[model samples]
Target: MGISRRATAHWEGDLKTGKGQLSTPQSGLLDNTRYAFSSRFGDEKGTNPEELIAAAHAGCFTMALSAKLTEAGFPPEALDTEAQVDLSMEGGPQLSQITLKVKAKVPGIEAEKFRAIADDAKQNCPVSKALSAVPVALEAELL
Candidate 1:
């Protein structure tokens, strides 16, 4: 069986000066949240697609890392992951890179083993697989 989720976006006006709203009906976490050109390209106080993608990648990779650790007999006590998505517009608008930073606490696990599992998780996570075309880098620390 396959699971599905949905979110909707509404935009009004042109691309440069346009305003938009995004919402996730099922979760309602984003209830018509605002996003615009300035918000995405400039440093404006609103959400952007890259930011949302980073958040989703972070969450998905963290869960995948947890599952990998558990399978390796080193269930994590805690895992903190941050995913940074880089958007470049040199040639055109493109998702250039994604960097993941992970700090994990797992008892009785050596740093080498933990790093190995984390590497595997980064390579095989659903989100990572989906974004395989983008360059992905990981900096994992066992704490």
Candidate 2:
């Protein structure tokens, strides 16, 4: 079975001054949510595509790590993952780098084993796979 998800983005006007709205009708997390150039590039506080990608990557990787750990007989007590997306604007807008930092709490798991599993999750997570064109770095810590 193939599962599909959808999100819609609506924009009006030009790139620099245009206003956009994004909605995830299935989840209802965003309903005509606002996005503007200022939000994306300036100091305005609002959700942008990069920020959303970071959130998605972090959530996906953490869940993937938990599943992999469970499969390895070392289920994690807790996992915290942070994904950072760097967008380069020199030639044009491009995703330059993505870094994933994960701290995991698991009992009886050696550092080498945990690192290997975490790297596996980072490489195999859906979001990571989707963004394979971009460079991704993973730093995993076992606590």
Candidate 3:
């Protein structure tokens, strides 16, 4: 069986000046959260699509890494992953690049093995696969 998640967005007005609200009904993490062009392209204190994508990517990759490391018999004591998504507007606004950096603390795991596992997690995570059209870079550090 496949699991599904959903979010809804409501917008009013034009692109440059329109205001929007996003909601994740199931989780309720976002209940009519506000977003706008100013938030996305300017210095407005609100959430935007790119920021949400970054959060999703970071969370998905971290969970995948945990599972992969556990399967390799080197469960991580700690795992910190940061996903950065760059939006470019050279021609048009598009996701240009995604970078995943992870720092892990696991006992008895060689650096080489950890790197391989981190790379695997990066390559196989659902979010990474979903964003495959964009260039993705991974930096893994074993601590």
Please write out the lDDT profile of model 1 over residues 1-143, one tens digit for every residue.
99999999999999999999999999999999999999999998899999999999999999999999999898899999999999999899999999999999999999888889999999999999999999999999988
Question: What are the TM-scores, per candidate, against the unseen true structure?
Answer: 0.98, 0.96, 0.98
Candidate 3 C-alpha error for residue 124, in Å: 0.3
User: Which tens-of-lDDT digit does each residue in 67-141 have in candidate 2?
Assistant: 999999998899988899999998999999999999889999999999999989999999999999999999998
Q: Estimate the overall C-alpha local distance difference test score of candidate 3.
A: 0.95
Candidate 2 residue spans exceeding 4 A from truth: none
Cα RMSD for candidates in order: 0.7, 0.9, 0.7
Report the lDDT tens digits of candidate 3 across residue range 1-104.
99999999999999998999999999999999999999999989889999999999999999999999999999899999888999999999999999999999
> Candidate 3: misplaced stretches above 4 Å?
none
CA error at residue 29 for candidate 3, angstroms: 0.6
Clashing pairs in 2: none
Ranking by lDDT: 1, 3, 2
Instruction: List the pairs of residues colliding in candidate 3.
Output: none
TM-score of 2: 0.96
Each prediction's Cα lDDT score?
Answer: 0.95, 0.93, 0.95
Clashes of 1: 0
